[model samples]
Target: MDFSGKKVLITGASRGIGKATAMAFAEKGAQVGLNYRNNIDEAKRTLKEMPGKGHQLFQKDIGKTENCKELIQEFIETYGRLDILVNNAGIFQHHKIDEIDFEEWTQTWETTFRTNLYAAAHLSYWASQKMMKSGGGRIVNVSSRGAFRGEPNAPAYGASKAALNAMSQSLAKKLAPHNIFVGVVAPGFTETEMGANALTPEERERLLAETSFKRMAKPEEVAHAILFLASEGAEYCSGAIIDVNGASYLRS
Candidate 1:
């Protein structure tokens, strides 16, 4: 869809899926807000590679609660509107239940939940207010399949995503009255920086075997799905979880 003049605020957009999503939106003629924490250089690199125009950055540690409101306000002030909010910024780690530390556990919980879930919630609330004043809008929460099936070692991360999925559903229900559509893109393992660094050869092969495609997803593949959900064309797709998993978990 042609998204000229549409504004999207994407979190963790310096690399991987977020970067790909931002570029895709830009190429489609949307103004993008590229959010990053510590990698301004990398974010700028991604921006330089983008095909379109009118993208800006707002760097803040979103894991901190205070930065959330600040970033959202900055987004509104910069773009003059918030048509789409992609809650894509997050951190991932593995843990064994017995070896998990209090700081580790709390950081995992706070960071993942705050960045993955709370960011969308705060932005959606404010963005929806803007969209309501102007007519309507969309929200695409970058969730994970881990949310639905859950994870063994990384319980906190899994639970946080699950909470985000639930929040999308609840917000969709509540926001539909004002024409705000909230949906989720729950992807399986993909060939992102985290996936490459975390997965061993044997583990990658094993994970690939889970998919009918026998491979990991490309960043653009998931971005295309997010674009669809975020479009005015998908106005009726509220409260839906679109699993872009290459048939990894297709039901019989």
Candidate 2:
């Protein structure tokens, strides 16, 4: 129930679920390391609101492969260790197949995959190395329910998330020997900027109507799930995909 003295890193921590997760960890006594891109002011503002020690910001875009390593490096340099890594940096673009340009499509794929998966992959590798040095650690990859339900026009985004599901499982097996746990949180429609702006009122209504709760979930709800998975309470959880969708994506 406590994360006292734990060093944790949260990517895309400048806003949304990432920011919420950071606060959750900080309040629980974990030292939070935040990663942001081109939003120094907001990142700092958010950091000021967090509740614990070691709250620092590392400006790195996961869209660029190299930044992933740099983020881990800066985290270690700042905190001397990494106890948990939350892969939350990702993007989504809506482009139908016929409307998708060759260049734009490539960029979309790279943007979504590199930031969503590869960055996580590199950081997982880097984090695992650090974890091994300290006996073990925890990794939580932020995925989406769209990975299972499919995005209307964000195919690359869906693929990237689905890939994280597989990747986390693989890494869990690899890192289990070292006591490091790897898992994913596949959130359904949540009240993040992307979620709120992704559809019009009518569209959002339809989306909400599909859920048992008939409303979008708060980011803190999903953050709570992430916190639990990283908790000592969830010590045996590895390669688990915890869904926080309010029954929107339940299998028939």
Candidate 3:
């Protein structure tokens, strides 16, 4: 599990699960590229907290195609090669069916898809090409339990995560021949900055009750699963989606 010379890039890495994942890699000796959109201060805080040196910060609005390409290119140029790509950047907006107007609903869908799914697709495309040239690499996608269980108020978010799972599987199969491994970690509600901002006291209580553990996952918990999927021995598990949902939702 040692990544002494590994170069990893994590998008949406300024805080929450992304930050935790970046730290996990850095602690294992990987040189990490932390990507954030608007939270420069928070991203800088994360950079300062990293365990190892040579970890760099990258600011990019991955929602745009050009930005996504640039983020990957910059990371490659800085580190020379990419060993892992973690697509953890995402946006969630509640565009309930009956409550929102058509325009609002459309906007939600467009923005959510661009940030959640399209960004991952574009980044993965460019990262995979670079990986192929350097022998091989790993791509670990951060999905959600909502992809399977559902997100009633945020239908677009649910749909995008589902699409991300499918995309990971597609790439896993396509990239296997080139020695690239792809896997997914689908986590339930984790106790992260985003979750803290989104959930109310009552909502948090209800979510806790719904889970078997009577609690939400910690960011570190999800990060451990992500690191495992990105490990060398996990090559045979390419295309696998490991659920880190604390038994909140089980799929047969």
Candidate 4:
């Protein structure tokens, strides 16, 4: 797990799991490039809290296709090489088929996919290209348990994450020859600002009851899985999906 001299780029790193992962990598001696959108204050706080030097922030809306390219370019220019890329930026919007209007439904699907799936695909392509030239690299994607079970309220969110999982596996197979490894971490409801904001007291209670631990996963817990997958000895684990859901949901 010693990432000394490694360079990593993480998206949605202003807070929650992304922030935790960035800090973990920093502590392990990796120079980090943190990406956040529309949250300069939180991003700055995360940057200041990092334990090491040579870390920088890139404020870009990764939901936009162009920004993904720009962000990777900026990180490469700043860090000289890329060792790991964590595609954690995502959106979860309620777009129940029976509840929302056609326009809103379409828009939600578009926005959700753009942010959750497309951005990750584009970044992986660009990052893996760099990794190919540099000998090897890792890409750890953040998915969701919703991808396996279901998201009655946010179908688009579930679909995007499921698609992300598929894409990661495809890349894992295609990129392995080039020394680029791909893995996924699918977490259930976690204790994060985003997750908290999306649930009511009753809803939170119900979700917690679904887990064996009777509680949500912590951001740091999810980050630990990401780090393990990104670590050097885990090259053989490429294309694997590790669940950090506290046994909230399971699939055969």
Candidate 5:
């Protein structure tokens, strides 16, 4: 879809799926605001890689409530208005039940939940308000197949995404009358930097076997799906979770 004149904002956009998604929107003529936490070098590279002009970068940590509020305000001030908000920033740390101590467990849960769920929720709250005034917009949340399939090693991550899906559905129903559409993309085993670093050769084979394609999804593959969900024709798909997991996990 042609996103000419549209403004987009993406979090954790220095690399992987977030980077891919930002580039896709840029290619389609949308001005993108790329947000990153600490990777200034990578974030600059991503901004340079985008095809279009007016693409700016915001280096802010979304885990804090105040940062989330300021981020939306800054993007609006820079771009005038927002058309899409992709909540792609997240953290995935393993907290094994049998090995971690109580303190470690609590830390993992707090960090994961804050970065993965609360940040998205806070951004959505402020972004939706701006979108309402602009007449209409789209919010696409990047979720995970682990939400339904189970993340045995990362229970907090799984739970956070499940909550994200629920929140997306809730907002979808709440925002429809106001012309704002909310949708979700739940991808499995994407070939992102985090995914690559998490798997060994043996683990990779096991993961491949779980899907019919015998391979993991590329970042762009998932990005394309996100773009589709953000399109005007997809307004009816609000609350729908489109799977990009190569049939690795199925939900009825």
Candidate 6:
């Protein structure tokens, strides 16, 4: 899909799937705004690696509600218009019920939900408003297979993504009449820094074995799904959730 003249904003673009998605959009001739909380170095590297120009970077902690609004505003100020918004920023933490104290448990849940769900919700709210006036736009949320298969060790992460999926569908219906589309891309374990850091060698091997491909997903594979959902002629798939797990998990 040629995104020439389109403007796209992607969160968590410093690395992994976010970085891949940002580069993909840029390569397709879209002006990209790369957002990252920390790791300015990596973010700069990603911006430099993009094939096209007009790719900018915004460093904001989206875990906060206000930051989400500010991020979208800053992006619009820089790019003039937002054609797509990819809510790819998320946090995954293990807070087992039996293993953590009440205070810690609550904190973990708050952080995870704020970063994973609330940020996306707030960003979408503002982005949709802009899209409404600009004629139309697309929003693609990066979810996880754990939302379906479960994350026993990271229940909050799993719960947050499930909520994200629900919220995306809800917005899909609400925004469709305005010509704005919302879709979701749920990927299994991907070969990213965060994914690798979350697993032990043994656990990694076991998880890979579960997939039909016997390997973890590459960040670009998930990016491809995100782009497809955001591409032209994909408005019909607004509320759909495309799985990129290589058959690791399935649900009817």
lDDT, candidate 3, residue 78? 98
lDDT tens digits by residue: candidate 1, 1-252: 888999999998999899999999999999999999988899889888887778998898887777877887898898887888888887677866789878877777777677767776776776777888877788899889888777787787788889888989999999899888999999888779977886779978888999878889999999999999998778788998989888887533
Candidate 5's displacement at residue 220, Å, is 0.5
Residue-wise C-alpha lDDT for candidate 5, range 100-148, written one tens digit per residue: 9999999999999999999999999999999999998999999999899
TM-score of each: 0.94, 0.96, 0.98, 0.99, 0.98, 0.99
Give Cα-based local distance difference scores for all models.
Answer: 0.85, 0.89, 0.93, 0.94, 0.95, 0.94
Model 4, CA-based lDDT: 0.94
lDDT tens digits, residue span 61-108, model 4: 998889988898999999899999999999888888998799999999
Question: Model 5 reaches what TM-score against the true structure?
Answer: 0.98
Model 5, 154: alpha-carbon shift in Å?
Answer: 0.3
Better of 2 and 5 by TM-score: 5
Which 10 consecutive residues of model 4 have the lowest summed lDDT? 91-100
| 75: Cα error in model 2, Å | 0.8
Candidate 5 residue-pair clash tally = 0
Query: Any runs in candidate 3 off by more than 4 Å, and if so which?
Result: none
TM-score of 1: 0.94
lDDT of 1: 0.85
Tell how far residue 244 is off in model 6, in angstroms.
0.3
Which prediction has more favorable lDDT, 2 or 5?
5
Q: In angstroms, how far off is 18's CA in candidate 6?
A: 0.3
